[model samples]
Target: MLLLAECLNQQGKSTQAVPYLNQVRRRAGLANTTAASQAALTDVIAHERRVELAFENKRWLDLVRTGKAAEVMTAHGAKQKRKYSYILPQAYNITSNRLLFPIPQREITLNPQLTQNAGC
Candidate 1:
């Protein structure tokens, strides 16, 4: 369904992209979305991506696009702090330059226009 949604979003048809997304989830034995607005839909889609595409490289771009890159990754790989797991890895420091992911070394050297982010 993401294929359809991606196409629709690219074509500025994201609102109409709902049906296709619903269809895809149904095929995966998932229920239909209950989101009531675009923001909710975006949140739902992000959670879906995290679950359905876990272990894949989906989070980085999603984080970057939402500008929650730091917020999300800071607690990444850590289960919620509830009555469950208590320890969490410190992935990124949200208040500092550590939030800025480093540019690839190859890209930096290949293109002088590129600059390295603070923490590399």
Candidate 2:
């Protein structure tokens, strides 16, 4: 189902992606997709991935792949800080430097030619 939706989304067929998206939503006891625009549908798919795959270790990768890690994480961090005083107020500041992870130190040590990613 998601494969079909992803294909349609990639083809700029967000309207057609609705059915497959809705299939996932319905199985999760959520309502059908009512997203009107491609961007909105894209948001729906991202959200669905977050909810459906929570704690499976894919959320961060998904957000990063979709170029939404910064925007989503910043808002999520702010909300967390606001809702819980115990939570640190400092939120994740997503920047270009953060888009990719630094090269592993072990790997870099093994290969002297390897350069560390910027802002590690």
lDDT tens digits, residues 1-120, model 1? Answer: 665565564566658867877877888899988765666666666677667777888777767766787666556534344325644444234554655677988998999998888766
The C-alpha TM-scores of every prediction are: 0.61, 0.69
Off by over 4 Å in 1: 3-14, 75-91, 95-114
Candidate 1, residue 69: the lDDT equals 75
Q: Which number leads on TM-score?
A: 2
Cα error, residue 84 of model 2, in Å, equals 4.7
Determine which window of 10 residues in candidate 2 has minimal summed lDDT.
87-96
Model 2 segments beyond 4 Å from truth? 83-91, 105-113
In terms of lDDT, model 2 sits at 0.83
Alpha carbon lDDT of each predicted model: 0.67, 0.83
